[model samples]
Every structure is written in C-alpha cells, then in structure tokens.
Target: MLLLSGCKVKASVWKWLHIAISCFVTAGGLLLLKHSGVVTGGTAGLALSLSPILNIPFHYLFALLNLPFFVFSYFYMGKSFTFTTIIAIAILTGLSSLDSLLPAFTIPELPGAIIGGAFIGIGLIGLFRNGASLGGATILALYLHRKHGINPGKSNFAFDFIVIASSLFAYSLTNGLISVLSIAVTSTVLALLKRKLATVKPGESRAIHPASVN
Candidate 1:
C-alpha cells in the first residue's frame, strides 16, 4: 500500500470525488477573481487577461491556452497523469462557463484577491494530493519537482510572477498589484502543504497514477 501522510488508503471513487470538488473550488475562486477584474497566474490568469482583449469567453480561452501544455504533460508526465490532468482542466473549464448563468456580482479587489487565492490554493492542494494538476505552469512545476527536485512552490511563483507582470497590459496598475497579492497568497498556501504532497525521485516512474492511491 502507498503511504499517504503515514496512512494507508486504497484508491477508489474518492479520487474522482476529490478531483471534482477541487475543480469546483478552483472554478469558484477564478470566478471571484474574474468578477473582481484581477488575474492571478498560469493559464487561468492568461485566459483572464486575454479574454477581454481577444473578445473571447474566459472558459474558451482557458481551454485553448492549455493546449500546448497538454502536449508537454503527455511527453513528460506519462499518460495516466496527462489524462487525469486533462479531465481536471475540462471540469474546471466547464465550471467556469457556468459563471455566465449566475447573477452578476463583484467583490472588493483586496478581499477578492485574498479569499480567491486561498480557495484556489486549497483546491490545488487537493489536486496535488490526488496526483493531478490543473495543467499549464502547474504541470511544469510538478514535473520539475518530481524529476529534478526543484521546489514546485518557488518555480510556480516565478511563473506566476511573470504572468502577473504581463497582466499589467490588460489591467490597471492597482489590479496588477492586487493580482500579485493573489498569487502570493496561493504560493504561501502551497508552501504550507508541500510536505504532504508526494514527490517522485529522479528515474522513478514520472506518472503519478491516481488509481494507486486514495
């Protein structure tokens, strides 16, 4: 049996349930940030920044931007992980699309950044714990951590910072700065949970099969 936080649990329907809940949480957080007119990081942030400029919906852009990353994931992360990641992305994308049906609402920028970041972070933790990711820079971060022992949090933060910097083109300086705060909050939460997430040694199987764990 695989050791998960020193506890043994068989993989079952719980894995799918975890992924679905995590995707829902992440989608809710992204919707909050979207309504606040702030972007965080990765494909989601890029999609947010580009949606208005490109005159496309966020969910559509989100899926399109992730195409290249899926290729990278397939090559580096193995089929099982890649498949699971694709499913996660689809779920998140579907959930994001539902925002159009909800009543229009907006959150204050600062609180949206803080609370949305926390929700995204917690959702990511659940995904990672289940050997899945939301794709984009997250796939690269997890790949690096698994194969080269780089800190996923640091790598993820660096990528996120770049995304946020680029977002300055699409948003006000205040919103850009607030977006940075959101990413920082997310990074902090990931850092706190890093120890509990699994890491693969170099040369070990790079694919983290979710079917092997609960």
Candidate 2:
C-alpha cells in the first residue's frame, strides 16, 4: 500500500507538470498566432475564427467547442485518456486567455508562423505523452493513426488545408498562406517527433496511449 501510494503521488505530480508545460507552450503559440494575424487548423483555428466574429473570449470558445469532442473521445479513447484530455484542454484554455494580459509584442509573419507552429507542436507532444489531447481534429487524426495505420501528420495536414482555405475569407491570402505554413510546420514536426517517440519505452512514461489535442 505504501508503494502504491507513492506511485499515485508520482503520477499526480507528473500529470500536473505535464499540464503546465503543455499549456504554457500552447498559450505562447496562440499568442504568436494572434499577433501574426493568422490561424492554424484544428479546434484552435475554429476558435480563432469565431472569437473575433462572436466577440467571445478565445479560451471560452476553445473549451466550449471541444465539449462534443470530449463525449466522442470518451467513447473512443477510454475514460482515463478522456479525463486527462479534459484537464489538458482546461489548462490550455485558461492559459491562452491569460496571455491576453501580456504586454503587446509582435514578430515578422514568416518567423512567427514557424516558431508558433513549433511551440504548438511541442505542447502537443507533452499532452500526447501524458495521454491527453486538445480534442478536435487531433482526436480523429490520432484515432486513424492508431487503428488504420495511417500517418497522422498527413491526415492532420489534410484537414488543416480545409481550415486554412476557409480562412482566406476572413484574412488576406498572404495571411492564409502563412497559416498554412504554420500548419505544415506543425504537422511535419509532430510526425517526426511521433515517429521518434514511438521508440521510447513505456516504462519511461513517454509512450502513452494514443490521443490527440487541438
């Protein structure tokens, strides 16, 4: 019982740390995207598009948009996975919203897109390693990758194309293209990292069950 209690404590600590790191990176990426006047794919992109039009907070919209996805995820990803995902999403939502309070800063479009995409990718890696996800297109991509042997990166990028294309209506063509570049960078990095992470031992706590985030 003592050993079991110790393990529980360790797991709980790991979960909180994972949530913090992922949320920080995700918030940083979203801030950059916002400053660059762009959007990427997944639930985040939807939130970005609607936030301005609906005049709602991005964090609230992000969490609300993911509600249905959570239900579906519970069925597909199992209870523990879905629960962790909820925690991850909640943290990300809160942190991303808090980022609005940060002093204004800006970056060049191309560099912002690249760096922001990488940050998002890093955040997702943390979430995935912790058996959590942002829940949206990411859930679908992970499901397909796990069950059908499809490349999640390609699948994710395919969905992103539609999301970025739709943004052309809301943003300039240049910005839309930059959004695509961000998504491309995100997907590519995720693919490479996923492949590398696959080689890690489960005992190391780096090979969690497949799940996805926005």
Candidate 3:
C-alpha cells in the first residue's frame, strides 16, 4: 500500500510539472504573436482567428479546438506523451485566458517579425525537450515524416504555409506571408537547435560553449 501510494503521488507530481511546463511554453509563444500582431497555423491560431466571430476568448477556443486532436493524439502518440500533452494543453488554456494580466507589449513590424519567430522557436523547442507539444499540424507533420520518410521540417513548413495562406482571407496577403516566414524561420531554428542539443553530454544544457555546460 505504501509503495503504491508513493507511485501515485509521483505520477501526480509529474503530471503537474508537465502541465506547468506546457502552459509556460504555450503562453510564451502566444505572447510573441500578441506582440507581433500575427498568428500561426495550428489549432491555437485557428482559435484566435475565429474567437471574435464565435464570441469567445482566444484561449478558451484554442482549448476547445484541441479536443478532437487530443483524442487523435491519445491514440497516435504514446501513452506517456499523450497524457502529458493533454494536461499541458489544459494548463495552457488557463494561462492564455489570463492574457489580460500580462502587459501588452508591441514591437516594430520588422523586428517583431524576427524576434517573435525566434521566441516561438525557442519556446517550442523547450516544450519538445520536456516531452510534449502544442499539437496540430505538427502532429500531422510527424505522422507524415514517420510514415513517408518526409523530413519533419519540410512537412511542417509545407503545412504551416497552408496555414499562412488561409490567413490571407482574414488579414491580407502580405500580412499572411510575413507570419508564414516567421513561423518557418522559428520552427526551423527550433529543429536545428534540437538536433544539436540532443547529441551533447547528458545532464548538461548548453547552447553556447560546452565548456560552460557546468
């Protein structure tokens, strides 16, 4: 009984931590978009675009939009990955709704485009390091990459372009194109950094000097 109880407690704590981390990354990515006045492809972006039309907060809509994908993720993703992802999304939704609490910071258009992309890229890679994801087109990208020998980066980029294209109807072709470039650059950087980080020494997180890995 004691052993069982301890295992359960550990599971609960892990769940909480995973959710917290997911929420942190998701909110961080959202903050980038908020600053840039742009959005990306994925269920979260879909929610933001439709929220005003549906009379809902972007956060709540994002959570709701994820339901079907969560079901797919649960079946398609491994149990551990899916389990944490669900919790991560729940916490993210809660945090996203709290946007009012965060100060609204905008950026100059060009700088915003570049910095916003970098922030989202790094933030996503952080979530990936923790063994989860925001889930959407990337999930589809993963499926294609695994099943068809397609490069994950290329798959995601193509899908993201589709997302960017859709935005043109709502915003403008120019604005839509910029957001696409931003997401592509960011996700590409994330993928590159992820590959480099994976081969480094264990128990060390170093993006700079590995001698600094202490």
Q: Which candidate has the highest TM-score of all? A: 2
Model 1 lDDT per residue over 1-214, tens place: 2477333233445667788898999998898898887789999999888988999999999999999998888887877788888889999999998998999888899999999998998888778776789989988888887777777778888999999997797688988889999999988888887876766432122223556545
Off by over 4 Å in 2: 196-214
User: What TM-score does each of the candidates earn?
Assistant: 0.88, 0.88, 0.75
| Model 3 segments more than 4 A misplaced | 1-22, 103-105, 144-149, 196-214
- Which wins on TM-score, candidate 1 or candidate 2? 2
Per-residue lDDT tens digits for candidate 3, residues 63-95, read: 777778767766766666566566667777787
In angstroms, what RMSD does candidate 3 have relative to the true structure? 5.6
* Cα-lDDT of candidate 2: 0.79
Ranking by lDDT: 1, 2, 3
What would you estimate as the lDDT of candidate 3? 0.63
TM-score of 3: 0.75
